[model samples]
Target: MLTGKKTIVFGERDEISATATSACLKAAGAEVVYENTACFV
Candidate 1:
């Protein structure tokens, strides 16, 4: 179980996975710090 820690989620243009990851992490009681999106050409 996540008690005390930090979590970060990077979308990287993947909205589906990124949102899921963020939710999961939040549910686990993690302090999400940063999120960034990167577009690749």
Candidate 2:
């Protein structure tokens, strides 16, 4: 697992991918330092 590791999650705006990704990461013991939902350019 990714325990004790810090990660940033950039979720696509108007999408669920971020939510799923963050959940998966958390389940793997990863620390989501920051989570953002935005329209990436």
Candidate 3:
């Protein structure tokens, strides 16, 4: 469980979008500071 932590997510565009991924992280008690869904591939 991540509590009082800061996390930055990038390019979570698989089955779940960036938002959903961030939400899941938040649910796990992580502080999602930034979420980027830009996939440059």
Candidate 4:
């Protein structure tokens, strides 16, 4: 389900939430390239 799209994430890395989200998004045909705890998106 990853489309391989450039993506950015900003949140507390307290759990696998971020990871899972990224994974799901990526699997959905998104090119995820970057990830951070703070991004002015």
| Highest TM-score model number | 2
lDDT of 1 by residue, 1-41 (tens): 66567876787564445666777888888877876566564
Model 2 over residues 1-41: C-alpha lDDT tens digits? 58878889988866756677889899999988888877765
- Give the alpha-carbon lDDT of every model: 0.69, 0.82, 0.78, 0.62
lDDT of 3 by residue, 14-39 (tens): 54578887788888889998888975
By how many angstroms RMSD does model 2 differ from the true structure?
A: 2.8
40 in model 4: Cα distance from truth in Å? Answer: 18
TM-score for model 2?
A: 0.67
> lDDT score, residue 34, model 2?
86
TM value for model 4: 0.48
**Candidates 2 and 4, the one with greater TM-score:** 2
Going through the candidates in the order shown, the clash numbers are 0, 0, 0, 14
Query: Which portions of model 2 show Cα errors greater than 4 Å?
Result: 14-16, 39-41
Order the candidates by TM-score, highest first: 2, 3, 1, 4
- TM-score to true structure, per model: 0.55, 0.67, 0.64, 0.48
Report RMSD for candidate 3. 2.2
State model 3's lDDT: 0.78
